[model samples]
Target chain A: DAGVTQSPTHLIKTRGQHVTLRCSPISGHKSVSWYQQVLGQGPQFIFQYYEKEERGRGNFPDRFSARQFPNYSSELNVNALLLGDSALYLCASSADSFSYNSPLHFGNGTRLTVT
Target chain B: QQQVKQSPQSLIVQKGGISIINCAYENTAFDYFPWYQQFPGKGPALLIAIRPDVSEKKEGRFTISFNKSAKQFSLHIMDSQPGDSATYFCAAEDDKIIFGKGTRLHILP
Candidate 1:
């Protein structure tokens, strides 16, 4: 079975531009979450969606937004990207949002570079 | 406030030696602790996890040691090998998951 998958393995955008990263959850998974990992640092939670509903959000600014489709896929959109926004964007999926303890399976992640 | 803190920032160990990474969390609501391993150019994967109710959990050469009272936990890698070299992150989960800064572990032969 395939694990989580993400599109646009690597992207380079100029400052003040917008970017959208996509993610597909594993089969039968209903929960999807997004994280941002800066170089030499761990992944930080950004947003989480379950059953196409916004379940939780992190401390990120309004420029960062995400939505999950009915099919359980997710998209993370960042507006007016800054150089600091450059990082590896990760997408994780789980069986459900209530089972937070259930380990999250991650995709290869989209590497975004704001130039 | 940082909910979870991990150290050391980097570690170097000889092959077959034990490598230990420690983490402390501030939230009492955190009942689940998990350790993730991430290689260069890849996403973090679950290595092993432990609940506050258990003192320890082992899988192969990886082990998780949990301390409920002190709110501290650690990951111990025994008989480490070069392939084990990567960034290890410890996370605490309450309503949301909070991760540590991560430790870069290098096991040299």
Candidate 2:
């Protein structure tokens, strides 16, 4: 089975532009979460969706938004991107969101470079 | 506190030696702790995980020692090899995962 899949492996955008990154979770997975990792830093949580509903959100600004579809796919959108927004956006999936023991499976991630 | 603090931003160990990475968390509510290993240009993969109820857990050459009272946990890689060279992250789980800054481990051949 595929672990997790993400599209647009690498992206480049200008400041103040908008970008959307997509993710497809493993089959039979129902939860999808987003994280942002800057250079030389650990990934920071962005948003988590379970069963097509937003379950949790991190400290990101309003410019960042995400939604999960019925099929368990997800899309992360960033508007008015800034140079600071340049980072690796990762998508993770789990069997369920309520189980702490459920390990997360991650995708390779989309590398976004804002210039 | 919501942060998970990890130490030794980088480490160098000889082959057949042990590599240890430490982490401390301030949140007492965190029940699950996990370690992830990541290679360059790839996403992190779960290495090993432990819960507060257990003092220690081992898998293969990897081990996790957890101290609930001290809110500390560490990962021990036995007989470290060059193939184990990668970035390791310690994380605590609550509503979301709180990840440590990360530790870059290098094993000399």
Instruction: Report the number of the highest-TM-score candidate.
Output: 2
Reference-based lDDT, residue A36, model 2: 99
Candidate 2 CAPRI grade? medium
Q: Listing every candidate in turn, what is its Cα RMSD in Å to the true structure after a full C-alpha superposition?
A: 1.1, 1.0
Per-residue lDDT of A110 in model 1: 96
lDDT of 2 by residue, A23-46 (tens): 999999999999999999999999
Candidate 2: stretches off by over 4 Å:
none
Best by lDDT: 2
DockQ of 1: 0.75
lDDT of 2 by residue, B1-109 (tens): 4489998999999999999999999989988999999999999999999889999999999999999999899999999999999999999988889899999999999
Task: Report per-candidate TM-score of chain A alone.
Answer: 0.96, 0.97
CAPRI quality level assigned to candidate 1 from its DockQ score? medium
Report how far residue A73 has shifted in candidate 1, in Å.
Answer: 0.5
Interface DockQ of each model: 0.75, 0.78
Pick the DockQ winner: 2
